[model samples]
Target: MSDTATVYRQRASARPRIEAEPPIRHVAVVGGGTAGWMTALLLAHSGYGPRLQVTVLESPQVGIIGVGEGSTSWLRGFFEELGIEESEWMPACHATYKSGIRFDGWSTRPGHESYFHAFASMLDNLTMTQFVDHVHRRLDGEDVHAHPDRYFLATRLAHACKAPRPRHEFPFDVWYGYHFDSVLLGAFLQRKAVERGIRHLPRHVVAVDRNERGDIASLQLEGGETLAADFFVDCTGFAGLLIDKTLQTPYVSYADALFNDAAVAMPTPLDGPIMSQTISTALRHGWAWTIPLTRRHGNGYVYSTAFCTPEQAETELRTQLGLLDADVPAKHLRMRTGRVEQHWHRNCLAVGLAQGFIEPLEATALMLVQRTASLFVDALEKGDLGAAAQATFNTAVNAQFDGTRDYIVAHYKTNTRTDTDYWRANAANTRLSEPLTRLLKTWLARRPIVGGIQQGTFGQGYPVMSWYSLLAGMGLFPDDGELRAPAAHEPPHSLAAIDNLIQRSALNFPDHRELLGAIPPRPREESLQVYFW
Candidate 1:
């Protein structure tokens, strides 16, 4: 046998085996939408015995907060774990592949007005070292090409309007996610969970009954039916029916750091070929997200009501979409931008908006939900839902939320726009977390960010490359006139070489529109009027 194969076998055999029975046999997930259905699906698929029953309590009267949503690469892993093929769910969800997000006009620096934050791929390993080197050199006032868009393959693919899927001959895998109808996705997951033997209870939670220990005990339905379970998962969006309303978990608001609390969303017709990336353009009061699905474009303006009225935000969005006089309806949403003190409090766990939300700039809503559900499953299996386990889970999950918040906060903090009061306020905001403050200081000092990022607890939310991309993309360095030629001993970077490599790598991926065309199309469903969750 090969030496590598022998080592792999030895390591695989050395791992400890788990044999304990699950502590909780019944898990009730309240509030059905993407969050509830997803949690239910994860629990149903968890290798727990058939004795463990998973139930989703969905209210029929509640409308879905359906928008064209984008996801991070985590969704790809979710589908892989469930053995659900892209061909199966993508068509059903009116989904299109997303390579990454393209930020437009977030910065006003010349040549840095826009940048693409591409999802990392296996191919990045070959070029990331040099990219980091160039970023450092540029920070040192050396003339160099360090734009993030130049080194990443996903950026090239997105620019070319190509899907992330490589040809059969290509050996490297490109990580990617999707843009889909949120409502359709929830429905799709509901179907999958039901098929996996998860029970679906469509009833409104009229009241939450708590045990003497302050943990959730049972839920009273509107129809006078009472449903009890060992553990409860709250996917009740902003209502926090189980976690907040019943358990009274202390909610921490991010309003001081993240100013955008209100959003106006509406759909627009697809005017041309589908693009493979979400576009986030800095608007007057806040930012606008343009997400392309198969049938239409999902456009929304997420702004602070403190700065502009909902009507003004909607008008701006309508003007941007050229629908100012058009009859299409717009959905206005109010967001409570913060997380609860404890995600897994006692017997109840909060997921989705019930847990908390950072803005959708990076399409992290579903990503956070998926992470929480996955972690809860692992904790349940290994720790048997013990107090120590719950504490540990809460600590880790809270850190994750904070870490994601720091990254999103950095976007506003580093923005160079001065066009509006919103931009000026974000620029001058001092309500940053200590971790973010330190990271910014380190970057401003032109020190190695990887070391600080490595030592920090909150930095794990985003990779080291992402920090580099954001800082470098925003042109957060010395003036161009101050740049000097590199020293003789300093190794040179070849922009042409990186460009050639990206162009060549992109050739393997098919056109985004053509790739969607190849997927078997499901019959289009009528648009459902819904509120933003």
Candidate 2:
């Protein structure tokens, strides 16, 4: 791992620049939809639209390839940070608070399945000392599920349909996220960007022009008109018109790390607006996801081409869910699991599907668009807009992709189901990331540092409370060896402390049903509703 301090020094020395000077004056964003609009939004929101001309070249033909919305904690926070109002979002996107994902039937022998919810919150939490004591007590023949049941609050609240309250109202209650329609979220972002004075031209990119230095200098539209810019952002989706096609940057395939390449999405209706939560279940050929949006449920099967064909996969989906709407079409999208070696090459940076993508297990794909744009703006702030800064930016973007790739891979790798071809394929896959391999070894030794793909992804912005949920609730506990709290820690808090908070806080909140009743009829997910106890 590179030292943070050293990386900073090397970065500054690599790109010497004028202080507070904007290296990129006129920026051209290629493509549209969520990624393009997101990039434009951030640029405009950061006060770049006024000083640097920001033009989003969108093609009505190149529609966004997104199913419903399943996003991370960052997604909501990003909107909140941007000061976008709740009503501006909720009504348009079938937006609702998402505590976490519920995975059903990934374990057990053929056909039989059980499930657990991977919440942003946790069950009861005991300090290290208390946890060790509980473990010891368990070893001595006592059941500790009761203690952990109290410790992890999310488990009970999910069943009860209660949202976590502010810290003063509960014990260890903090951090939350959302589940909104992807298409609507994209529209919301586009509207905000335009409101901030961003220029959006609905034009399809026909060709990419490069200067002698191999940097993208202009974009040729379908009408034989050329648009020029000092810096270009390739939000062009998979075509990569500006980033790869013009710059000739090579892409590294992550198919080996992330096996599932294709997904079939179907929109199924429920009786009322859907509740907030995405259910990702492990299927035989691949994993299937059921997301309950406000008006309809978004269902998808993501599987590897090696295991099944599109036609076969579609058949399986239909058999599982019965026929989707006869009038509306069910779409099947194909993709490779990986990204460009350089997300930012030369003056061109590729965002969204163009940069790369893994399967959308946790909705990291959407956040990637926002994160990439925000990070580049950070780089720009560092006055490292020269060639060196660009290279470093590319390297850092790849790191983020690789990190996310491994994180998603962990979900499949840490599982122990091997009943069907799909499970077998995911299980037999021996390749794992270096960090994951180390974590797995630690977990095997019962030292439990952080194991599998999805372990410990939340950083300072995200705390231990979040990671601990997926760790314990999903049955991916670290081994007994690592269960001991770090040397100087105190005993964990009592489960009673956690549960009592929920019990008390539940009284103040409106019935989940009541809240839904007050809202307008949502656009989708008519059948499902979720409440926290």
Query: What is the per-residue lDDT of model 2 for residues 1-533, given as tens digits with 9 covering 90 to 100?
Result: 11110110011011223346576788898877888887887776553326767999889786778787687756654664455555567668876656566767665422224444434332222232344355334333343431233444444444455443323333343234566678787787778888888888888877777789877788888888999999989887888877676777898888876788899988888664344456787777788888766677788898888888998888888777877335557798988777988887888888998899887887788778878998887777665587788777777777777767765776677566767776666767778777656655554454533223224332212223333333343455433443434333443345666567656654543333345444432222111112111
Off by over 4 Å in 1: 1-19, 519-533
What CA RMSD would you report for each candidate?
Answer: 6.3, 7.7
- Clash tally, candidates in order: 0, 40
Error (Å) of candidate 2 at residue 195 is 1.7
The parts of candidate 2 lying over 4 Å away from their true place are 1-19, 47-49, 109-143, 146-150, 162-174, 272-274, 324-328, 450-468, 474-497, 511-513, 516-533
**TM agreement with the true structure for every prediction:** 0.93, 0.81
Looking at candidate 1, the ten consecutive residues that score lowest on lDDT are: 4-13
lDDT of 1 by residue, 215-253 (tens): 788999998999999999999899888888888899999
